[model samples]
Target: MRRQTARLYLAALSKYCGSRLGKLLGVGCGNGEFLAEASLKGFDVSGLDVSADAVQTTNTLLGREVARCSTIERAGLPDHHFDVCVCGYVIEHTREPLEFLSEVHHVLKPDGVLLLVTAASGSRPVTLENALLRTGFRSVEMMTSASRVLVLARARVRRPRPLVSVIVPVHNEHRTVARLLETLTAKELTGADKEIIVVESNSNDGSRVDVLRFAGTPGVQIVLQDRPLGKGSAVRQGLRHARGDIILIQDADLEYEIDDYDSVIEPVRTFQCAVVLGSRHSGNGKIRVFADQWLLGLVFNSGHVILTGLFNLLYRQALKDPWTMYKVFRSDCLHNLKFECNRFNFDVELLAKLIRKGHTPLEVPVNYRSRSFKEGKKIRVISDPWTWVWACLKYRVVSPYGGDCTRRTENEMGDVPDTP
Candidate 1:
C-alpha cells in the first residue's frame, strides 16, 4: 500500500498539477520554465509575473510562437482555464503566499491543483511540509522525491488520485532486469493505485532470474511465459496481471531513456486520453536518435508512417506511427481491445483496435536512441512494409475490433502463432 501511495503522490506532483482542467492563470511565470514544459506536453497556458523582465525572458527563451505576455491576466485569459496553478520558488519570497495561493485557486479550473516547490524554511524541512500545504489547498502530498510538494485542496482534481501500473516485458535481459528490479523496488507507488508487474518470456538469457529476485517487493509481481514468445506477447501477459487504472508498456532492453517514474507516468496520470505513444520524432530527438541503417531505412520509416497512417485512418484512428516506440494505455481501453498479431505486426493491430473502438490517442516525445545490429535488431527482412501491411490488412478484416471481424470458431486462426 505504501509503495503505491508513494507513486500516486509523486505522479500527482509531476504531471497532475495542470491548471486543474488545464485552465489557469500563472503568477510569477518568470522565464516560463513550467509554462514551456506544460505547453510542450500539450497544455494551454496563460501566464503572469510582477516582473516584465521575466516575461521578456520567457519569450526570448521559447520563441514568440510559444511564449506570450501575461501582464494581461486581466483579460481573464479564458476563465476556469487552468487545472493546476504553478508557483515556482515564488512562495518563500512573496509577502502574501496565501493570497497568491488564492490567486492560483481563482484562475485554476475548479478542482485544479496548486504545485508549489520552494526552498524549505529555517530548520531543514522534512517531507512533512506537504501536509501543512493542505491547510491552504485541498490536500497536500509529497511525492517520491522529497524536494517537491503537490497541493490539491480548494477544488478537487478530477482524478483525486490515479492508479498506475508499470509493465516491463522481459526476455533474456538479466543484467538490465537487475537494475530495473532495483528501480521498481524503490518506487513510491501505492494505495491500490500502483503496481510493478514484470512478465517474463523464454529467456535462455537468465533474465527471469532478475525478475524473480523481486518476488517479495511490495506491489512487485512477476508472471512467467510458458514458451519463448515475442515482445508484444509478454506485454499482453503483463497487462492481464496489471492492477492499476493506468498502464505503461516499456521495453526491458534499457535503450529507451527514462530517469524518473513520474516522467514515465506523466502522460496518462492527468488526462482522459485512452493511450499515449512515446515519439522519437519530437524535440531534441536529433541529439539522441541516430540514423543507424544507411540503406532503405529512411524509406522504411516513411513507409511505416504511411502504411500505419492508412490502417489507422481506415479504422478511423489518427496517429503518427503505431508500430514504433513505447506505448501506454488505459486498462479499460485494452479490455475492449484484441491483439490479432502476436509478433511485430501486433503493434499495428493495437492501433487498429484503438481506432476501431473510437479512441483518439495522444503522443509524448521522449529521448530515443537506436541500437546497433549487434544489439539485437529482431526486425529482419520479412518484418517490413510487406509484413506490416499484410498483417495490418489481415487483422482489420478478422480481428475482434475490426469492422468485418466475426469471432471465428476456435478451430480457425488459432493454428497461427501470435507473433507480431
Candidate 2:
C-alpha cells in the first residue's frame, strides 16, 4: 500500500508539474518511501517529519541525511526555495492546517507546485480547495482515488505576464503619428499584453484626423483635449484611464526607436527594478546630431550635459539622460503622489519625485534620431531651461506626497498601492 501510494503521488506530480527534476520536498515523509522513489525519478528530494525515527529511517534508507526531524512550521526553511512539495496524507493530521499550508506556500517558488493528500472522509473537496485558496494557491484541482483525496495547486505568488500601458502624448506629429500608432498596435511587437493610450492635444496639422483613424480599435484608447496643454497634462489625463500593471511614456514623433521597447521593459518585467529609463546617450559614444542643425544641436547637447550634471548632483544620482522621453515604470509607483507640471519641466519633476520616493531608475541604452526644428521640435530653447532648473530646485524641497517630505525607511518604501 505504501508503494502504491508513492506511485500515485509521483504520477500526480508529473501530470501537474510537467517536469519532476527540480528541488522537491516531502512533508510528513513516513519511512522515506516517497522521498526515495522521487529521488530515483530525478528529483533532488528532501523530507521533513515530526518523528525523529521516521527521519532516521528515511536517511538510513537513502544512505544519507536527506530528511529533517521537524514540523514544517519549525523547520526554518528558506522562502521560495522549493519547486515541488508533496504532503501525503498529512493535512488531515495537522493541528493548524491553514498555518501548515501557508508555510508550504512560503517555501515554494513562485511557480512551484503543491500536492496534498488527505483521507476522503476527512473534509469535503470544496472546503479543502477554499483553504488552499486562502493560503495563496490557485488552480486548485482535486482527485479521489479509493479512500484518499489528492489536491493539486499552484502558488499564487507567480508573476503573470504584465499588461503594459503605452501613453503617447501627441502634439503636431501628423507625419508619424498614424504610422507610430499602427506599429504600436501590432500584435508581434511584444508577447505581453498592451494598451495604447493616445492623448491628442488638439493638433492643427491634421494629426487629430490621423489619431481619429485609430478610434474604437481594440485595446486602443483615444483622449482628445480641447486645446494644446503640454506633455505633462496629457500624461496625467492618461494616468486617470490607465489600467495596466506597467506604464510607459512614448513620444508620437519617430525620434525614439520602437525596437528598444524590450530592453527598456525587461528589468521592470522581471521584478529586478520598478523604474527604467531608455537613455539616448548611455552606451552611444556621441549624441546623435542632425547635420542640418549643427549649431542648434550643439546648444541642446550642451544644455543636456549641464542639466544632467545638475540633476545628478541635486538628487545624489548618477543618471545619464534624465530627460529622455522613454520612461517606463510600474503604475503603482504613482500611488499617494501628485503631479503638477504642465510643460517640458514635467520630465524634471517626475524624475525628481520618483527618486525622492526611493525608486531610483535603471537606465538602458537606446537608439535616438534627432529631428530638426523644421520637423516640429517643441521645447523652447531659452525659457524651458529656466523652468527645468526651477523644477529641479522646487521638487527637491517640496513634497510630492501631499506636503509629507519625510524620507521613508527601506521597509516603509515597499508599500506601493495597487495599480488601477
Candidate 3:
C-alpha cells in the first residue's frame, strides 16, 4: 500500500513540475518509502517526521542520514531553499493548518512546487485549496481518487517589475501640464518603475516652460522641438527616447484621470493581453461629451459612434472607443511593424495596424472628463474625421508583411513618415 501511494505521489509531481527534478522534502515520511522512490527518480531527498523510530527506519532504509526527527515548525529549515516539498498524509494531522502551510511556503523558492496528499474523507478540496491560496500559492490543481486527494500548487513567483515609459505629448495648455506632471511623477501611483518622456512641441501657451521645469527630474526626459508639430509627431519623437518594457501614451490635457493608470496597465502587466486601451465608454451607455459645449459635443459624439462602428466592422473587432488616448502595451508588440501617420489619424492607424498584426487590444473602463475646443481640444471636426476614415481603410487592407511600402528596417523603433 505504501509503495502504491509513493507511485501516486511521484506521478503527481511529474504532471505538475515537468521533467525538472531537484531537492525534495518529505513531511511525515513514513519508513522512508516515498523518499526512497523520489531519490531513485533523481531527486536529492530529505525527510522530516516527529517519530524518532520512523526517522531511524527511513535512514536505515535509504542507507543515509536523510530523515530528521523534528516538526516542520521547529525544523530550522532554510527559507526559500527547497525546489519541491511533498506533504504526504501530513496536513490533516496538523493542529494549525494555516501555520503549517505557511511554514511550507517559507521553505520553498518562489518558483517551487508543492505536492500535498490527504485522505479524501478528512478534508474538503475547496477548503484545502483556499488554505493554499491564503499561504501564497497560485496555479493550484487537485487530483482526486476514491481514497485520497492529491493537491498540486506552485509558490507565487516574484517577477521583476517592468519599466513603464509614459509618453506625454504637450501642445499648448499650460494650465494643466504642471499638475499632470505632478500626478504622474508620484511613485505611489504605480508598482512598476516609470520614465516620463515629455515631448514639448513649442507650445505658444507657456506649456514648454512648465515641461522644462521637470527637465532635470529623475526618470524624466524632456524633448524640446523647434516648432509646434501634431500630437502624433510628438509621440513618435517620444517613442525614439522611450526606454521602457511597456509604452503608454498620455495627452497633456487633464481629460483622462491619472489615477486610472494602474487599471489601464494591469492587463499588460499580468500578461493577460499584449495591448490595453482605457475605454471611456466601456460600461456607460450614454456618450460622454463636454457639457459646456453641448452642440459641438453632440456632433463629436455622433462622429465617435460612426467612426468606432466603422473601425469595428473593418478590423473584425468589437472594441469600444478605439481612439482612446490611454493606449498601453508592451514595447515588443511593435516589433516588425511600421508607423506612418503624423496627425490625429495616427490614433486610427496605430490601433488598426496593431489589430492587423494580431494584437486585439483589451479594453478597460477608465474615468474621463471631456474638454471642449475652448479648453485646448485639438481634434478638428471636419477634416480629422475624413482622415480617420481614410486611415481605417488604408491600414485594414495593407499587408502586414514585407517591402518598403509596408515594412521598414531602419531601426528597432521603426519608421515615422513625415507629415504630407
Best model number under lDDT: 2
Candidate topping TM-score: 2
* Cα lDDT, all candidates: 0.57, 0.82, 0.81
Model 2 vs. true fold: TM: 0.61
User: Which has the higher TM-score value, candidate number 1 or candidate number 2?
Assistant: 2
lDDT of 3 by residue, 83-138 (tens): 99998788889999999999999999887999887777867665676577557676
Clashes of 3: 0
| Residue pairs with backbone overlap in model 2 | none
How many backbone collisions does model 2 have?
Answer: 0
Candidate 2 lDDT (Cα, whole model)?
0.82
The runs of at least 3 residues in candidate 3 whose Cα sits more than 4 Å from the true structure, single-residue gaps closed, are: 1-159, 187-189, 282-285, 400-420
Q: Count the backbone clashes (under 3 Å) in each candidate.
A: 36, 0, 0
lDDT tens readout by residue for model 1, 1-420 = 122332332344454443224444455676666566656555676666766777787667567634444433243555456675655556666565445554555566755666554543431222223222322343333221233323334443334566677788787776577886676556574332567888888688777777787887887888888886776787777777876667777677666764534554665554435577776665321322336655545555556567757776666665554665477765655543556456666677776666544456676656656654556555675555576788667666664544333212223222322110
Q: Which candidate would rank higher by lDDT, 1 or 3? A: 3
**Model 2 segments beyond 4 Å from truth?**
1-160, 187-191, 282-285, 404-420
Ranking by lDDT: 2, 3, 1
**Could you tell me how far off, in angstroms, the CA of residue 307 lies in candidate 3 after the best superposition?**
0.7
Tens digit of per-residue lDDT, candidate 2, span 145-213: 445567778886633557899999999999999999988887443457788999999999999999999
